[model samples]
Target: MLSFTRGSFSDRLFFHHHSHLRALLQYRSTQRSLSVVGLLPLSIVMSGTRSINDMLMQAARSKKGAVAAGRPPASHIAVEKGKTEKKKEQKVSAPHEKMKESGERESGRKDKSPSTLEKSAVAKINEPCEKDNGTAVQNGIEAPMEIDSTREDKENGTIEEQKDSDMGLEEAKLPDSPDIPKISEKISLPPVGVSEVPSITECVSNLTKRQLEFDPKAAAFWKKGEHVPFAFLAHAFDMISCESGRIAMTDILTNVFRTIIFTTPEDLLPTVYLTANKVAPPHHGVELGIGDATIIKTIGETFGKSDAQVKSQLKALGDLGLVAKACRVNQRLMRKPLALTCAKVLKTFKEIAKETGKNSQENRRNKIKSLLVAAMDCEPLFIVRLAQGNLRIGLAEQTVLVALAHAAVLTEKPPVAAAQLPGRLEQAAQIIKQVYSNLPDFDQIVPALLRVGIQDLSEVCHFTPGVPVGPMLAKATKSISDILDKFQDIEFTCEYKYDGERAQVHYMDNGSVEIYSRNAECTTGKFPDVAGAMTRYKKDDVKSFVLDCEIVAYDREADHILPFQILSTRARKGVTLSSIKVQVCVFAFDLLYLNGKELLQEPLRVRREYLYQSFVEVPKEFSFAKAITSTDLEEIQAFLQDAVNHSCEGLIIKTLDKEATYEPAKRSNNWLKLKKDYMDSVGDSFDLVPIGAFHGRGKRTGVYGAFLLACYDEDTEEYQSICKIGTGFSEAVLEERSASLRANVIPTPKVQGRKCCGCFVSFLFL
Candidate 1:
């Protein structure tokens, strides 16, 4: 049988000693006010009464010394083995039921005339009077209604529903307090304060009222302690059925946090809706706010600890974790900075039932011993989490946001929607927070977040597909130096290039998949891991997701990717999982089409921001390709060397500027690459871009090795080869070159025939 119990250490202790009268007697309040004491159950008093009742009934049925009684004592029913009521003891105890409800005892506090001896003398008169029987029956059902719920009442939720108007109170599921010993020592508990009910009602009533008095411009409802800063967020696209986007809800809009700032609640529906579709990738890592680092440092200083110590403390609260060391190398998982989590604030007097112990395991069986509610959301994925980066199927921050929105259970969607909702983020969030607090199920959250705003709740499909993602690279590279040198001033960045195949991974609405290589070839079978990763990480019922990544080969450990040749291992049919271990590393460079929103025209900076913001971190085996400043030949060289050292051939540098479009099948200059082997050896730089090729001859007959190479004749409208160099050759290269020639082969391909590529076309000494 499954058992559900929860509570904190203090709560458990309280539950264990709940029934002790001696403990209650230590509290003057319970002793002075019987009315209050009677409301709560005291098992000991009742247990004594049951025993007395049984003995009394047995004695009444006994005949006092008839003929049979004289024959033997065997028929005499003794209450105990060697005990009996004393013949001289005529005193009876006061009926506990009457003593419990009679508030006349409180009258003594008002008028203290009776002495202790008088009270003792009067105690006998109050004992078992014939009138006690009538009062006992009436008080048994009415006065002792202190216990919250009967077993049956709790099971059907009749008591909960009736108590709070079906507000989900039954879900609390707290454990039962244990029986207390009558003679145990007292325990002290912190004072409990009653919330100001009227004030709470006031805040809840005027929640959505526009033009609130405090500060119309500032979105806050000046509450005690601190003001809540709220912003309303909305979603921005349509999606397909298989995707997280709720196509029907794409149009939904909401302002969640706006109201929450001024003491208003969040607008959970729209935010949840926007998140459902993954408008952004699902990473939760974020750049620290201005001065936040200093603040952390200051706090650490005040605590007389190093930044690391402060950070560790924060991690204990689930606020911080390790980070990556460098872009080129494997992630270092450092904890340089600290942040916070929802669990941090909730540590105050709040704990789950599963966290406590005290009650017997058997007694605690399936007892919904205790429950606590809190609003929680995921942070963006950092470089530390290898797989859950901006790649094939890792979750990003936006996914978490969506999940949170859905958790709120507002009008089916998060506050974010297709329509802009920057003005409403704060308010939308509060509402969602309430929803999340009440119900924390993933299914509930996903559907709500995916629901397109302003849609008929009856719509079968919520998410849409074909959302274009990426135009997000920078422009204006006067020199590689311009990118490398000026990045910091504008917070710009550059990334490394990979020599593997680039894939435009499409997640179809029908739950199908298609992976298109840069050359527009369908290479889906060549990389099954890509599809499998997506299927697993993506939320259930998500129909589609289109991603951009580099597919490279791998050894047994998926951490390192092999060269292009290794990709051949998976190029053929009937490749068993173990037979061919050259797995592929789909290096996710960016997020293109997530859910239904298209980010095509957005700048590279914007795209990267979205990518980083959306994804939640997962560990290595998959990851986002690291990036840096585009220029600084020195840095680029270092990066290129790093890439090469890691078995990569080159580095592709991307500008953070967003003017460039990611033209699939088109090699635009915006994304230029520098290979480790491309440096000039003797003199002049080669102008070959692998333009066209010719049929092979001689030893290269079956293969296309001695094929024509091209140099750009800028003056002409065509490309002509200055050389046809073919020196670096291997059997495998010969075969691959032969196969690749069919597409690039030109009918009238021409070559200089005299000298080959990389050879000095000596204009110097000629």
Candidate 2:
């Protein structure tokens, strides 16, 4: 037997060869009984197998048994050997102090004679031991050896080897082998007190409970300023889309707005516009102009697919948004894209809108592709839909306003109980809706709301001269009797409802005239003649005014008002005074603003008086709507007939006195439209075919809600889209019709002579 003390050269050599000795033992034990392998002991195995042939024989025999005995397998042994060689090379190449420190750390345990240590280790290995739980225990060490053995068993082979090794080690009663010193214990101090870091749940809870504090000076989430990720808005849209209840959608939007108000107040305007599926105010006339083909092409390019493949996927998915989401699954990028911010997205959309003239389509495609490439998660779903000019998430402009109102109130830190919160929210929502009705410009309203709070929002934003107010609507009346019965004893005026487009003409203080449609779309370019005619008709004293009127196609020589179909024939854009083929006459009715003063709060009678005094009639160029102030049924019926005779659609009976203030964006009960069509049965009917449908929302969810009806043109051999019908069907009828139409559904519209009308239909019939 060889004996040496710790730190001796021989002892160091023994320690270095320890892993090899174990490998030899593993081989011997597998080929024969443990008693036979233990006969030679660790010293003779280490000393005897010095030659190349002897070592090769030992390694070959040990290969199977080494793996079977829960030792490091051949591959693991090779890796370990490589690691050991690298460590040796580093130690040899290192500075003298580093080598010395490593040597001390490896051998720093209390010194013991090599013979004594060998005896102790041999005694521990030879003794039979009970299992500690399911693990084999050969020494004091528990976890590391057991874990390595279990891992090797899984990696190298099956559990049979592990079971045999565990049982063999437990049953074997071998003679003493040389001892191996235990690995040094790494001293890990217990963490000082509880961890200082808060959990994700705790952080979220804190944010929810924390009162909102608006700090204009505080650093924003984005580099430029306070801006939210576009993903945040997409997630909200996703949640709102999945939800069918209007109240639930409102709640989700409310929370989304709250987060934006707290973290990035500057992004609130863009967020609001995106939520409403708009890039700018309606009167701005900004449109994305991205077609389905362009969107499909952009998606295909981003995901490395053909347009046909994208179209195929779109057919399967019905929605381009879904197609985008599905295609993104396998998408790879050259580098990680910059995170999209709300302001960045709005800016991109505005850029897309500005793209026009030669190569405009290609430019738009590239911009859209960039957006798709940067989009992550459900963001692609919304980006596609937003480009299509519809979100289809059941989030109405009214609902967004309601949510915005509530979010603003909550951010103000209302000093009220939970019971009072709902009332406060409702009051704030009403105020916002009212202000938005009068102003209808988020660019003006949102900043004002955040500045003066919801209480004074109206004072800050109301009836601006350049911005068009939402036109007040009227409820349809069945007959003159219904109007008479509803307005019993209330002073009213009956005016001719001309068969023409509703126009709101704004004469600016700079002597510039602008015209807006009922939906607030700019039509100044479409009707240059009408704008010129308005200037000629206006009195010299009328400096700046907003006139609510009807622009009708009129015959100058015959002195007759043409039908609405004739007015629709005029060019919608780029029309010059010289190219005025379809001449229009403006019949001014009510004055909303005059000489920089808002008359919205004034009675209809007073506003009407202002309208008549401000502008004079110019025959076919401009005039006032013929009106009669009477309570008699016979007189009203005669006037309605006269209106019909003059190519008017019906009569607009409006309250002239009490409760008659102009209510923009409202379908007021104070005004009623007695159309000639409502007084009789179906006078005209067309055999229209259902070619396409719009997906249902709200109560009509999960079924077709509206349909695109088209009439066949025999001469063109095509189906010409006539109109879209949504109101006549009941719930049961819609489902029944949807079932029948669903079977005929095609992936895309293939009808000939169907012009690009910018209508997004959910499903198309063959």
Candidate 3:
């Protein structure tokens, strides 16, 4: 098993930005297109700057190419006019007159005139400067041994003997500032051809070997080790947007898992939770409590849309997330959005869940709006969906587990093949599913799996005292014969199924007790007596264990169990011993966990043996259910009859096969329920007042035969009309009652208010 610390990967990747880029490149090359990766650069700021530099370098290359291809040199061209141009021109031309005269004298020839073309060319070459304090010019070929003082030279210093110099060469270097290359041209990317693309597996392998992180500005891009842009999940959503089949979803989810496994495995848990549209497991009790009204208000407030506008969109689109998406798309005033990450999304959800006090709704609304503000385009659509818990991608927890299992298998030393992947995946998924059934929290499961592996994770999966495990359920059967046929050649046990609330009672080593209902909701206070009764039986073998039983209302004086109605009178919470009215008994039928070890895999026979030996039984207070094991149909029928006679609902037939084990969140055939509802019984009656009559069809078409009835509520001081009395009355009874009801039928305007206020019809027979 591999042992590791949290944030180790993040620390390694965060500080080294280049390795992050290398990972990103490998990821893009191997899995998605570069265009998809374009928006999510490893370093957003640096990528932008690199693009600008590339453009500038390309322009410099083009300019150098133009020069080598015989284009005019930039520096030698005519210069643009500047602030000092006139003064510079006057200073330069002053030296030309002397140089021309000196050239004529030196050549020993009278220079009567120069060609117009030659003069203009000379003027252009000598336009900017004269060397050595204006002693040189464009026209001068050479000069030696001169002593003179021009207006400009005299102001500077005394004239002395000077040497000949080239004026045209000096003019070439006169321009003080260099010209910049034009950057107006467009740049294009190379085309992606078929030969350039890589396989998904290859891409995954390459990504696994590299590290990745986002730019600093994208620091908001990660939350608790999860990266941003949200595009990764969005892309996966796009792939399965229209897919419906389980196989197709599994394929898509498997790929998504592969993507996360290779790129950002830290996000796996949050992504799974989000995909499941849950903040945490049911047992963990984390709830967002965000409602439609809150989401609507947030959309209107954050996106600048009016309630009417949002309502109109909702009327057209039906989904609030879609409405939010539309509003954001059409918003005139949009804020620059920070990249959204799985971690950030989960963090926001956690904060929203943790908010309490009087202003919690307001605080929650603000947090939700803030998240919406940071979302862009399709991101808002998904963000709203996640907030609303309406991800509705047709993915369930089971499918996600399967996907995670596939990812785990692929991450193995010798990767499982695609053909053999499904079988291995199923095996991995069952282990996770079983563990989750007991632990029931992805927050605990996913991290453990990441640190160790599936095998080690299965070992850690055990029933804890405080945490509730989903109780195993049974399939319903109609008769004793049906139950016998199902377990024909097997040894099965039949126990009375009591008429009471199913509770999972956990006794912790600290001497604390908790009782949870079948739905895994805490009902500890409601069953205070049950907890107190179990404390007496806390032996060495049963100090800390989970017991599955039926908590029934008990009549202490009569020494018998009461109906479910008596138990229903108990308060839900804050049940005080002094205030107790409905005394109850816990009929424990099965033991799942004992002394901190889960016996869920033990056969029913073994579990029952342990359950019987663990604790002392007290009649009608805390005792195991009466059981009789047999294959005889007649004996089972007698036991079923005895259960009904003793006020039990019916019988619970449990399979005693060696392979029979407790499977949570599933209704297996190994356990069967036969309730009294399937048996014959005398019907119960209710106190109902006759209201109006309905004419029967066909046989008594014209006559008012059936009567409408209502039940009286003592507390509300109002009568609630319910059910129609159409079947019980005979012709003789109806005939004797017809006249009395007619005379007593009150007129609509004359009816007076009392216990019953509507128009009344009283039957004399009653």
| Estimated TM-score for each candidate | 0.31, 0.67, 0.62
Using lDDT as the yardstick, the better of models 1 and 2 is 2
* Evaluation by lDDT, superior candidate among 2 and 3: 2
| Candidate 3: pairs in clash | 20-212, 30-203
Residue 344 lDDT (model 3)? 81
Off by over 4 Å in 2: 1-226, 332-335, 413-419, 682-766
Query: What would the per-residue lDDT of candidate 2 be over residues 165-241, giving only the tens digit for each residue?
Result: 21121121222222211111111211322223432233223222222332312312233344688876776677677
Candidate 1 residue 74 C-alpha distance from true site, Å: 99
Over the full model, what C-alpha lDDT does candidate 2 score relative to the true structure? 0.68
Model 3, poorest ten-residue lDDT window?
1-10
- Per-candidate clash tally: 140, 0, 2
lDDT of 1 by residue, 452-475 (tens): 322322233222233222222222
- How close to the true structure is residue 722 of candidate 2, measured as C-alpha lDDT? 81
